[model samples]
Target: MHVPDGFINTPVSVAAGVAAAAAVAVSLRGARRELDERTAPLAGLVAAFIFAVQMLNFPVAAGTSGHLLGGALAAILVGPYTGVLCVSVVLLMQGILFADGGLTALGVNISVMGVVTVVTAYAIFRGLLKVLPPGRRTVTAAAFAGALLSVPAAATAFTGIYALGGTTDVAIGKVFTAMVGVHVLIGIGEAAITAATVGAVIAVRPDLVHGARGLAAPLKLRVDGRLVDAPAAAAPVPAAARSTRKVWATGLVTALVLAGFVSFYASASPDGLEKVAADKGIDQKAEEHAAAGSPLADYSVKDVDDARLSGGLAGVIGVGATVAVGSGIFWTVRRRRTDEPAAAEPSAA
Candidate 1:
């Protein structure tokens, strides 16, 4: 849900900005541990993929549609900290470039869509993994459930935020009920997308999937009629599997295809938040986006006449810019982690 400007008051918006900033700061530090050579680039791809998939809004209800929130998918594919950053990156790009999300409400969107979804979904995912039998199916099932819940969780969060700082006078209970109700339908779509994507990645490169990392049970040996943990073995990494180039290229191509062409077929109805806001009078005070003058505003090129070409070009540009910026940020984070000085071993007495 891209919260537009004027939906929230200045003080509450600023407070949300501070909270979002703090969360990002913490995530950046946590991401240092999560990012590595293999994952850093893949993380960027995940962000780009999320951006692309979000463009394809599926119909959820009569007048409302839903898009991939990307929190559960990202957390399952990468790590939670990086997942938050991934969604944040997409939000940033959409706000500044596409003029989709409002600049003034950037913090509110990030807090509700990025942090809340990632935290809630990842917690549920991990919890389900702990209880469910370990397997690829289990991973996918957990991801589905996590994603299913994350959408409504984010909607509930927005409802709470609105109760605190909503610009218009509306019934808090009505807003909450509507937001959660519509988003619950949206969550079904989210769950399907997340589960399918996670399953696909796990099938191709389970090594790259952070949540699926430990699926392979540790070897056990029976000695003297007692079971003992076998010594860890260094499995040989295939040259092809070791290189993420193929996977990266494949993912980028998929994102390009989706955003550039497939997006044209996406549902044109308002998304869950927009529909809810309109129904509940929340958009009465919504202000125009600051970037409305941008050439690429509203996901269309300014001078391009052909609707398909303009929209496609804008989508391609968005995907390219998002990947470039996301990759740069993740690469820098990865390098910072690797370049740190190693702890020196203590000298023998």
Candidate 2:
């Protein structure tokens, strides 16, 4: 959920800002191990895809809708550290460009939506992957469960933050109950989206999916009444050489369709967090977004009379901006990793 301004006080927001900065710093280092030639490109696509799917909010309850949180999906498709950065990039873009999330609450949104969700989902996913059969299906299942749990976990975290620095005098227990309850429903939707997306990629290019790495169970055959492992095949052509090009092409096209076309059909209802906050009076002190005057505020282009066109253009712009920013970050991380060895050799020499 995009936490707006006035929901959390200044002190808590600043604390969250520090936490978010630390998380990004850690992710930048961790991502070096996660990003390589094959995965570096996909990382950008993952961010853009998350941005696109997030626009298509599905109905969860009478008045509440939910969208893809993308932590588990990104972590599963790429890696946990990179996933945090991916979601953070989307949050930053949405805040500054689309005014979807508040600028003052940027750190809160990043901590809750990016850091909390990625860490929780990745932990559960790794745990499950250790016990389950080493295959794409198991990884997909784990991704689904991880994503489902992460949403509620983030909700609980936000509830705690509100308890500490809430602007209003609402009962903490009620806030917890309401926030957790609605988010649980939202979590189911999140899980399905994560599973389907991860599963699709795993089916096509398991080699490219970071979480699916090392998951290929060797094929065994009986020869002369004895079981023997099949010979490993040559590394199939690089993902870029054989399939990744097509996959990336298809993924980018799909992102465009979802953001530019399908989003128009998405329900106009308030999302889960928004509905909950309003109904429970949690947003009684909610302040207007600083970028409310931005041309793309509220996901609509300024002076665009056509509701469909305005929203479509905004969605397209968001997807493009997210991809550009995400790719730039991932590329820098990848380059840094490459540079480390050269720098180290100079010292050794």
Against the true structure, whose lDDT is highest?
1
Residue 41 C-alpha lDDT in model 1:
92
List all candidate RMSDs to the true structure.
4.3, 2.4
Q: Write the per-residue lDDT of candidate 2 for residues 14-38, one digit (tens) a residue.
A: 9999989999999999999999887
- Report the lDDT tens digits of candidate 1 across residue range 54-122: 999999889789999999898888899999999999999999999998898999999999999999999
- Model 1 has a clash total of 0
Record all residue pairs in model 2 with backbone atoms less than 3 Å apart, i.e. clashing. Answer: none
Candidate 2 positional error at 83, Å: 0.5
TM-score of each: 0.93, 0.94
lDDT of 2: 0.90
